[model samples]
Target: MAFKVAIFDWDGTLVDSVEHIAESLHQAATELGFPALERNAYRNIIGLGMVEALDMLYPGLSREQMTSIREGYARYFFAKATMPQNVFAGMADVLADLRTGGRGCAVATGKSRRGLEKALLTSELGQHFDLTRCADETRSKPDPAMLAEIVAFYGIEPHEAVMIGDTVYDMDMAQRLGMPAIGVEWGVHDREALGQFSPRAVVGSVKDLRFALGI
Candidate 1:
């Protein structure tokens, strides 16, 4: 069946925020006197929720410490007012094409509700998505709850939706729901890593992604 909904992952998938995210994680760990993770280590956990990512980065932390780290990460990430998070090239056009094609567009991201909302406002891309589900509000990526909820909200079956993301977590989540998933190369994980989840297509550029989504 033709896809009726296109669900995207925010950070590395739609926007080029990997450096900011890695920096935030490093800064958060440093401020807390915790061992700072390497850039690649931070990148590995990009698709996880803040709480989950912190736990993986600094195990055996108390609840208070976790909260502090989360706050510190947010502070560092959003501190530079001039730093603009740019959407992937041609992605705006992809969203517009999807909209014009009568397909619903939405976000299923590991970011907190507040973070996602801030990004939408900052990027001025909120108008493109019909709905958004954040990790903090529901189960994070790798869990099917977020996708399941999105599909239900749109009154569509899982098969009618396609997940476009750059992580194995995103692909796995869609797989759990029996939904098709398309992987993007410009994100956290490489094509080989994402391929383990058996994505329908692993696109290397926004142009290929547009074709993959049939937009």
Candidate 2:
């Protein structure tokens, strides 16, 4: 409740796009002649940048293969209609309330610039954020660099901002900066996986998340 800035993750934290993302990745993998794994495999890599995620999924891939995956994934992702309804229930209201209360709201996401732009356009919730940093623009998650950039933009200290995300990457990024993080359970990881990072809290639902934010 003492936080001045609220930074959120895009995919599972803000939107219910987990299944859609996993399916798209699988489609892209199949298109590239790569062996498509289970949805959970894709889920584990959800919060990472595309290239980073692919590397984790299929290590030692050729650069050409990486490019193909990227293009193919983007194509498949956009082919599925992502509408404003994809946003998690009450998430839009939370963002609006944060902005209305003069709290800085930002996004530190693994989504590419183009991907985030497309999502923002479709969702129409982009205006709620004061700033957004895409993985393509900075170091990806599990690294604290992008979060550092976000806090620096608002001229606030790390402790003044709270990161709300669903993955260990988010928790790890916040921990590296000695910042507070609230892990949402509905995303990639379960409560047990998220607790290993010693987050401020691990919430199970939107109501719980709101209480953590005091919004």
Candidate 3:
């Protein structure tokens, strides 16, 4: 059956923002007198919301410390707004094509509602999506809540939607909801790593992703 809705992950999947993410995370740690994490350490938690990501990175921190670090990270991240955070090549056209083909596009991201809104505005890609859900508004990835909500909102069955993301969280979430998933390689995770979740296809480029989605 043709996919009626296409749910996407925002950060590493659609936009190239890992460097900025890592920089902000490192800054947050250092500003709090904590040891700075390596770039890969930050990348490993790219698909989680800020709170969850901080929790994993600095386990055992007090709630107050977590709050402070989260604030600092947001400050550092948005301060670098001038830095270029570009969409993957061909994604704009592909999104338009999908819409033209009668497929509704939506975002299911680990970003906070405010962060995702800013991204959508800055990227000018907000018009492409029919619906969006953030980690703060729903359970984070691998929970299936976000996708389940999107499917329900569209009045479509689980199999009528496809999840496209770069992490195992995305694939596992979709699988749990009985939806098909496609993995893109250009994100934080590698193909081999994402493959462990058994995505329908692990695509290396946006071009390949278009083919996988048949858009």
Candidate 4:
């Protein structure tokens, strides 16, 4: 195998939390007197951070309103939602295969630290990942800080690592850090959007991910 380390994105990439996210976004929007987004619109915002997603939803919202909406969203999310989300069909099997192959794996997500813990614990996917970097622990994506942190923590050179994600933020960060990225098609963004970051390749399914690793 050409890669020793693999890093994944949490939200739309590994887990299908779009329904929970939309429900929470709706609750927050209603509280803020803003219109709730349709499922598709909210899905488009899936890979972005909370602030960025809210900004897109209500562009004219004041900073204070944004803060309130975000807080409300988190409250609703934690109270009304339970995750492990919906594991992308073959994700668990693929992860297990990777682990068994002696590849080191981790996660970098915009999800809060606690949210990540809850999701991992619920999914029982924690055993597959060696480390997890969440928004609370590092700067949000598109910043490269999280990716850099993961690379450093794993003690691997950037080239020895591959980021697998479904968004431009993930791909762009990999690009910035001189690492390879494989974008997922069945995620928040489509191939065109992911292509903007020039990932090494675009994977249409979990089975393809094994090929991405030359398994």
Candidate 5:
């Protein structure tokens, strides 16, 4: 059966903002005098919430440190706003095709609600998705609640939906919810990392993703 709902992970899957996100975190850490992690280290946490990612990156933070870093990151993240134009080529078209095929489109992301809203506004891609779930609003990725919410919103079975993302958390989230997953390697994780969860397909490019989805 064809997928009825297409759930996407925002940073890597829809837009090429992985670097921007990582840099934002780096900028935050610098301002707060926190030591920076390697670039890939920051990228690896792309699909987790800010707090979770921060805790992982800077363990044993006081509430004040977490709040400071979060706000600092948000500032740089917005100030460095070229992301709307960074929407991956063919992604908008893919979304249009999916909607035309009577499929519901949604987002299951690790970004905050405000951050996602800002991205959606800047990118003007908000119209493409029928629904969106952010980490701040619910459980983060690898926990499955975000994907489950998208499926529940569309009233579709797990098999009737496909989660597309660039991270292991996305694949693991889908796996936990019994939903099929498609891994896009252009984001954070590579084929091998995303593959272990048994994604339906691990694609390297937007065109390949179209083919993978039978679009």
Candidate 6:
């Protein structure tokens, strides 16, 4: 049977924001006089929110420093976050195809509302998705809150939706809700990491995603 709804992860899955994200965190770390994070370090935390990423990067810093760093990152990230980002190849087409096929699409992301809106609008892919569950409105990734909220909002059972993302957090959330999940390899996480979550299928590109969904 076709899925009734599709819930997606934002950063790495749909929009290629890893470089922009890493740069923001690096700038924030520098502003706080903390060690700058390597791309790999930031990559590992791709599914987490900005504040949470800062907290992980500067674990030894005091709460005050964390808060300050988070503020600095928000300022830096918002200023240039959409610059390096673009819709992953074929993702927009896939979303459009899904929409045409009468499946509803939503985003359940760790991004703040402003950040999510900027990325989606700037990338010109916002029109395809029907709902957005941002970090400000729900608990962070790896938590089922965002996914659960989307399911509830659509009045659909967990099985009626499939969460598509590139991170284990997405898969974990799907598992928690007993929903099917498809992992994309082109995103931050590799097959090995995604394999640990045992998603229903691991796709290498956005084009493959359609097949994974059995479309």
For residue 190, model 5's alpha carbon misses the true position, in angstroms, by 0.3
Q: After best superposition, candidate 1 residue 192: deviation in angstroms?
A: 0.5
Candidate 4 per-residue lDDT over residues 1-215, each given as its tens digit? 48889999988788887678878888888877787667777766766677777778779788899889888888888784444447877788888888988999999888888888888887878899988898767787778888888889989899999999988888888899999999998877789988888888898887787788876
Tell me the whole-model lDDT of each prediction, alpha carbons only.
0.88, 0.92, 0.88, 0.83, 0.90, 0.83
lDDT of 6 by residue, 64-165 (tens): 887887788788878864533377778888888889899999999988898888887778888998899987787888889988889999999999999999
Which wins on lDDT, candidate 3 or candidate 6? Answer: 3
Comparing 3 with 4 on lDDT, the higher-scoring candidate is 3
Pairs that collide in candidate 5 are none
TM-scores, in order shown? 0.96, 0.98, 0.96, 0.90, 0.97, 0.93
- What overall lDDT, based on C-alpha atoms, would model 3 receive against the true structure? 0.88
Residue pairs with colliding backbones in model 2 are none
Q: What C-alpha lDDT, on a 0 to 100 scale, does residue 104 get in candidate 6?
A: 96
Question: Model 1: C-alpha RMSD to truth?
Answer: 1.4
Report the Cα lDDT for residue 152, model 2: 93
| For model 4, the run of ten residues with the poorest summed lDDT | 80-89
Candidate 6, 114: how far from true, in Å? 1.3
lDDT of model 3 at position 187: 86
Model 2 C-alpha lDDT versus the unseen true structure: 0.92
- On residues 1-215, what C-alpha lDDT tens digit does candidate 1 reach at each position? 27999999998998998888898889888977888667999998998888788778888899999888888888998885312348877887888889998999999999988888888888878899999999999987788999999999999999999999998899999999999999999999999999998889998988888777766
Model 4 alpha-carbon drift over 4 Å, by segment = 59-64, 79-85
TM-score of 3: 0.96
Better of 3 and 5 by TM-score: 5
Model 2, 28-121: lDDT tens per residue?
8898799979789999999898889999999999999999988888888988666888998889999998888889899999999998988987
Q: Residue 52 deviation, candidate 2, in Å?
A: 0.9
Error of 3 at 36 (Å): 1.5
Across 1-215, the per-residue lDDT of candidate 3 in tens digits comes to 36889999998888888888988899888988998877898888988877788888989999899999989988988875422248877888888999999899999999999888888888878999999999999998789999999999999999999999988888888899999999998888888988888878999988789889987
Displacement of the residue 55 alpha carbon in candidate 4, Å:
3.2
